[model samples]
Target: MTENKIIIKLDKDKKKELEKRFSQIGLSMNDYINLALNQFLIQGKVPFEIKSPSYDISTLKTKKAMLKTEEEDIGIIKNSISNSDN
Candidate 1:
């Protein structure tokens, strides 16, 4: 079989976090991808769910979009809702 290469771009914070988690579990990002690919080939389907992010409505952007607050800046931790719910 012919080989191929795939490139992926990740956010800096997410890359750091994933690296930490993978290290704790004795795995690299490439190892994880290979395992996932093998699982897909064995099962003939994707093994994980693709879900939207949960949104923080307390953030300034959300409030601004809703036009429900006087605050003009993103605030600290407050609350969150499922992206699917909105």
Candidate 2:
């Protein structure tokens, strides 16, 4: 999988908090993205809604959406692979 750098616009405090959370799990942003992509291919669908965010140049503020990570996807992927053996 090809990896790319992403510049995220988030509050300093929230970004710091997320960095800490990611560090605790030993998952860098790229690793998390690859995991998500693997799940998407395994599931054969985009997990999140596909929408273009409306950007406001004048206000310099955009609507922010947070994606919650799923810990159960690993188990789900394992189940999918095991079931395929039947």
Candidate 3:
């Protein structure tokens, strides 16, 4: 298979940050970018959505609150069961 090269410019800081993230995920920058491009070509769009950290933190808080509410409800149900058994 013939190979082609593509060149693009990025901010140095952003490139460094992307390299760090790619390293953490055990992929080289070249491989990661190529995978993304291949996916975009096949799907006709970027494969993933970029989300803000604040959004992620808010979602986490919401999930925790829901879990706490469910736990409280379970405790109330258990108490009612025991009370009825008396």
TM-score per model over all chains? 0.53, 0.40, 0.50
Candidate 1's displacement at residue 9, Å, is 0.6
Candidate 3 at 61: error in angstroms? 25
Tens digit of per-residue lDDT, candidate 2, span 13-78 = 987887788889999766777787888999999878775545454333422211111323544323
TM-score, prediction 2: 0.40
Q: Between the candidate structures 1 and 2, which one is better when assessed by lDDT?
A: 1
- lDDT (10s digit) by residue, model 1, range 1-86: 99788898999999999989999999998889989999999999898976544554456567565553233234443335434755
**Which residue pairs overlap in candidate 3's backbone?**
none
The deviation in Å at residue 16 for candidate 3 is: 1.0
Q: Rank the candidates by TM-score, best first.
A: 1, 3, 2
User: Using alpha carbons, what is the TM-score of model 1?
Assistant: 0.53
Q: Show where candidate 3 strays beyond 4 Å.
A: 50-86
| Cα lDDT of model 3 by residue, 46-83, tens digit | 99998887679888899877787787687843322244
The global Cα lDDT (0 to 1) of model 1 is 0.75
Model 1: pairs clashing at backbone N, Cα or C within 3 Å: none
Per-model C-alpha lDDT, please? Answer: 0.75, 0.63, 0.84
